[model samples]
Target: MRRAYSVETVRAAEAALMQRLPEGELMRRAAAGLAVACGDLLRRNGRVYGSRVLLLVGSGDNGGDALYAGARLARRGAGVRALLLAPDRAHPGGLAALLAAGGQVVDGPDGLGVLDLVVDGITGIGGRGGLREDATGLLHTVTRDRTPVLSVDLPSGVEADTGEVHGDAVRADATVTFGTYKPGLLIDPAAEHAGALRLVDIGLGPELPEPPDLEALQYADVAALLPAPGPESDKYRRGVVGVVAGSERYPGAAVLAVAGALHGGAGAVRYVGPGADAVIARYPEALVHAGPPSEAGRVQAWVVGPGLGDGRGAEAAVADVLAADVPVLVDADGLRLLDAETVRTRTAPTVLTPHAGEAAALLGTAREEVEAGRLAAVRELAARYRATVLLKGSTTLVAEARDTPVRVNPTGTSWLATAGSGDVLSGLTGSLLAAGLAPRDAASVGAYLHGLAARHGSDGAPVSAQDVAEGIRAAWRDVRAG
Candidate 1:
């Protein structure tokens, strides 16, 4: 698992560690790492010696880090220049060290004639909103020149805790973060600006708290969570998933959902909806019912919604599934018919899967707001519905009502934006729930496989919903093999 700490937590850990170390030792360690990364980047472009390196220095420790790094580069025969945004507030010690090493300070943007690399130390994790007008203007020139930028910690102007970018922010080709990952580096919108991330350990791990604010699962983690059966296990001993989806108008939704369930490690799939005939045609293995979910016989878990339209039958089916004693997953049209009181009172776990638009409708807010602040929106939805909420998008997040670390899916691709992809995800996750995985684990694992499957299917081209569902088996094998 990849863990990310909030700014407040990171600050506290840094403070605790700094108190125990020598006065300037901590900063020196950070600068050493930064300078090494800069040299490596310069070497990749050409040679470190005689390379033109420009530092965008601000009024904080981030500026100090860049200045000290510039001093190191100067000593190595690189032509280092510092463009101090705040001359009076710059670190005095770092400034003296840079001058001693033959580093020069440029007075204006005109001094930024041509550069091999630009180091962004304009703002640190504590800075909020966006870049100031003066800094933004200077960065425009750098951007125009298409110079590769390396941010000190994170891309300036993005919230380290929430990953929200409100205004103009520096777009770095790469970032060398200190100690550990920040939420901004992992989440989207802000993550889009943070090109590539490298972590330099400064030995602050001992001071940080257990159960970080956010976590992303890697291959081994997903492999452990995947369901496996023994030789003695029978179909019943494994798990059965019940799916209620599709209307006469949208029978394809039911077919896609069943396809996902069949490949999601379930022993059998029992489907109840108006699309029974269509589902039967596609998958004869699936057990079909013509009535409500109550008459669908025994099932370990139920997946409701998908292509269910806004008719009386669809609403009634949703209600019937929600009242069941087994775990239930609601998606698509089912999300529209949800009642807060009914879901909150459920004894079994409930999982709500919604895109940004559906999530916005649930919260009675705008889609733009939910998209911009996905971390907050998903948490709020989980608390409001008292369930495990999966907010699907570029970064699929799974959050529970409890105070556990939110899971951010790292395998998502743009190709998953295809229609019926979400329906497939709903059925897959529901199957995991039937197999006895917790709501959080099921959602996270389902998303991980769903994304990997998309990648396997796409391979860089467009892929359909059926292609994604069919690719799940390959994704499963890949995870287990690892």
Candidate 2:
């Protein structure tokens, strides 16, 4: 798992690590990494030697890092200019070192010519809100010049912890963060501002806690979580997933949902809805039932409400599935009909999969608010429903009501925005739940595989929902092979 630490945790870890090292040891380590990244970036463009690199310097250690890194670049025969926002408050040691290395300080870069790169050391994790007047103006200058920027730790103006960008901030081409990954580097709006992230270890790991604030599962992690049938395991022993979906008006919903479940680890799929005929037509092996989910025979877990249009029978289907004595994953129309008290009082685990609009309705907030604050929205939904909530969008996030870690999925592409994709996810996750994974694991692993499938299905072209569902088997094979 790739972990992201909260700002407070990172600060505590850094403080502990700094106490054992020499006074300037940590900063030197950070500056050396920053300089290496800058050199590489310059080398990629052409040559680091004789290249012009501008440092947008601010006060505190952030500026010190930029100045120290500038000194390194200057020694390499690069023309390093320091645009000190606070000349008087600049780090004395770092400034003297830069001057000693033949680096120059300039009040304005307006007269400077084209630069290879702009280094943003205007703010560290300590700074909050947005960029100040001086930093903002300097940022505009670099933006107009079209110089690719490299932020020292994080972008200058983003909220380091919450990833809320309230105002103007530096948009970096890449960021070389030290020690650990901060919350802003993983969560968006701020995450979007931080381009390609590169973490440079400064030996703060020993001081930090093992558990992280947020995490994303890698291939090996997913592979371990995936269920593999044993030699003695039969279809029933492996698991059976019951899907209550599709209305007469949207029969394809049942087909799509069943598609995902079939491709998932589930040995059998028992589908209960009005689209029984349609589902059987597409997947003949499915055990179809037109009755309520209560009469659909035994199933290890249940997936409710995909394409369950606001029809009369859809209500009964949702009610029956919710009453089941197994894990339940609610999506689409089921989310619309969900009651706070009912879901909260359930003994079995419940997972709610809601897109921005559905999540908005659940929290009684606007869709825009949910999109802007995905982490908070997902957490709120999980707490309110007392269940695992998967908020799907550009960044698919899975959160639980418990104090467990939140999962951020980074494998998907924009092509997954097509219709029926979410329904496929709901069914796949339900299959995992039936296969004995916990609610959080089921949701997160399902999302990771689903997104990975979409990426493979798309492969740069537009992919339909069915194509993505079909690609899940290939994605599963890749994960298992990994």
Candidate 3:
């Protein structure tokens, strides 16, 4: 897993490294890494010797890093020009080095269109919300079309800790982050603007403090975390997922949900709903019950509310799941039907999976607001409900009520938004819960598999929910193959 710590942690680490190193060693390391990355970018585009490069330099150390890097490029025979955002405050040492290396500084953003690359060093870790008005105009003028942008330390205007954009932030083609990955580079909002991310080790590992506040699992970690059935494990031993979903109005949801449950490594799936007959017709292995949840046979965990409308039956089903002392996953209409306080009081772990619109309703905020500061919104939801909240979107974030580190699911694609897809995710996640995975792991693994399945099923085109479910076995194999 690639872990990201807060800005404070990174600063402390940098400070510690500085104390142990010779003067200017760390900055030289940063500048060297930047030069290498920029060179790689030029080589990838089939040129380096004569490529035009523009450096948007500021007053801080970040600008110094870029200026020194621009000097390196200039020495390599590439035409390099620096646009000084803060002329008076420019790094004295960096300016002297650039001038010595035959690099020239420009007074403004004019005539920057012909450059093949733009290195944004307008702000660094200490930067606050948005670009300064002066910088914003320059960014707008320069960032049209597909010109690749490489940001130093981080993209300007993005909050390093919260991943929130203050006003206007530079959208980079790639970000060259130093020392360690910042929380914003790994989380959404800020992450979305960071097109591609590359970490440049600046030899500050010993100074870095504790484990990160947030993490995104790589394939190897996910592979290691997956559950496998042993000889002693029977169908029942694997796990049982009790699903109270669908209704007279939506029988297909029950079938789809059961489809997901079966593929989710569940030994058995207990269906309790008005759509029992439909679920049985599609998935005969499912034990069907046409009654209330309490009367249904025992199950290891429960998944409620996929295709469930806002009716008495859905409300009662949610109540029964809440009453049970087992891990519960609530989704779809169930999210709209229950009160956050009531769900928070449940004895067992409760995982709520809601898309932006559903989450908006739960928090009584607009979808736009929820999306703008996704990390904050999800954490807020978790704290308010005292449950683990999974905010699903371009970047799915799972936050626990306690101080447990936040998990940002790196999986998911637009193709995964087909009808009934969320139902499959709920069922699959619930099955993981039934199999005894913790609430956070179940949600994260489920999301990873779902995203992989979507990619496998789509084959780069459109796909349906059935395709996604059918492809889960392959996705699981892919996850394990790593």
Clashes of each: 0, 0, 0
Writing each residue's lDDT as its tens digit, candidate 3 over 135-191 gives 988877776766789999899999999888879899998999998788888777898
> lDDT of each model, Cα atoms only?
0.92, 0.89, 0.87
lDDT of 2 at 456: 84
Q: Using lDDT, rank the candidates from best to worst.
A: 1, 2, 3
- Clashing pairs for model 3 are none
Model 2 over residues 404-462: C-alpha lDDT tens digits? 87888878668889989988998899899999999999998999999989988988889
- The C-alpha TM-scores of every prediction are 0.97, 0.97, 0.96
Using lDDT as the measure, the top candidate is 1
Go through the candidates in order and give the C-alpha RMSD of each one to the true structure.
1.4, 1.4, 1.6
Model 1 misplacement above 4 A: none
lDDT of 1 at 277: 89
| Predicted structure 2: lDDT | 0.89
Model 1 / residue 99 / CA error / Å: 2.2
**TM-score (C-alpha, index-matched) for candidate 2:** 0.97
Q: Which regions of candidate 2 fall more than 4 Å away from where they truly are?
A: none
Better-scoring candidate (TM-score), 1 or 3 = 1
